[model samples]
Target: MFHIVFVEPRIPPNTGNAIRLSAATGADLHLVEPLGFSMTDAQLRRAGLDYHDLASVTVHPGLDALWQALLPARVFAFTASATTSYADIAYRRGDVLVFGPEPTGLDARVLEHPDVTDRLRIPMLPGRRSLNLANSAAIAAYEAWRQLDFAAP
Candidate 1:
């Protein structure tokens, strides 16, 4: 399975959608705080994610803790500034796909993190900023899953 990590997420519905994506793809979800909303917030529930859909999620206090837990795996930072396409890489099982918050994408410090294996971006129209958080994760996760031939555990 792949690992989807959201750093300092600032939206509830996006994360709720990610939870559903995680459930559907069997890819684990990891969130780094401080989140914009509580896990129990009504907005999250309103997105239609339920307890079972959240089973694959794991919340981390910070990036440091996340590195410790997910070491020995390739962590790709998704950023608009990246020169490499997300599809260029040969994804393997247990790879980690990391995304930044909504309003602003990943900061320079995060892109420079030692644990981050490389940077990637999804192609978009010229002058367009970026895709929705949940949508980006879904795109990358589906690509990786497809590369693995949609294997099941």
Candidate 2:
């Protein structure tokens, strides 16, 4: 399974949907704080429904901690400004798909991190802003999974 890293996410419903995504895809979710809402947030739980316990979700205090834990993995930071398309990559089992906060997206510093193998983007029609956080994650996750033929028994 792939690793989904959400850095400084501010929206509860988005994170909740991501939790569901993790459970459905067998991907682990890593959240870098400081988060805008509590893990026990009702809205989040409601959005995730009964899948929270089924997903492997971990929260890290900061980016350093996240980097330390996910070292040696191919980390692909997703951003709308990137030149590379998300579908162009040959994703592996342990690859890390890193996303930024919903409001601001990934900072320039985070995007330039030495650990990031590349910055990727999902193509959209002309003049569009961006897709929702969870939607973007689902798109990337399913694309990677599809590349591997779904890898289900």
Candidate 3:
């Protein structure tokens, strides 16, 4: 399974959607705090619907803790500033796909982390800013899963 890491995510609904995405794709979701909202936020619950129990979601106190827990895995930091496209990588199982918060993307420090294997971007129209956080994550997760043939046994 792939790991999806959201660093300092600020939106409740986006995180909620990510929860549903994780459950659907069998991917693990890790969130780095300070989260903008509580896990039990009403918006989060509404977006996640009944998939909360099915999702594998973990919360890390900080970036250091997240790094410590997920070290030795190939970490791809998703950022709009990245030159490399997200689809270019030959993603492997257990790889960590990292994304930043809604308003501002990954911080420079996080992007420059030693653990990050590469910075990647999803393609967009010439002047467009970015896709929704949850949408981007779902795209990355599904692409990785697609490369793994969905891992059906």
- Against the true structure, whose TM-score is highest? 3
Q: List residue ranges in candidate 1 displaced over 4 A.
A: 51-54
Please give the lDDT score at residue 153 for candidate 3: 16
Cα lDDT tens digits for candidate 3, 90-123: 9998899999998899999999998889999999
Candidates ranked, most accurate by TM-score first: 3, 2, 1
Question: Residue 54 lDDT in model 3?
Answer: 94
Clashing pairs in 1: none
User: Could you give me the TM-score of model 3 versus the true structure?
Assistant: 0.98
Ranking by lDDT: 3, 2, 1
Total clashing pairs in model 3 = 0
Where model 3 places Cα greater than 4 Å from the true spot, the runs are none
Instruction: List all candidate RMSDs to the true structure.
Output: 1.2, 1.1, 1.0
Q: Which pairs of residues clash in candidate 2, taking residues 3 or more apart in a chain or in different chains?
A: none
Better of 1 and 3 by lDDT: 3
Give the C-alpha lDDT of model 3: 0.94
Residue 112 displacement in candidate 2 (angstroms):
0.4
Residues 1-153 of candidate 2: C-alpha lDDT, one tens digit per residue: 889999999999999999999999888999999998999999999999999989999999999999999888999999999999998999998899999998789998889999899999999998998999999999999998888788851
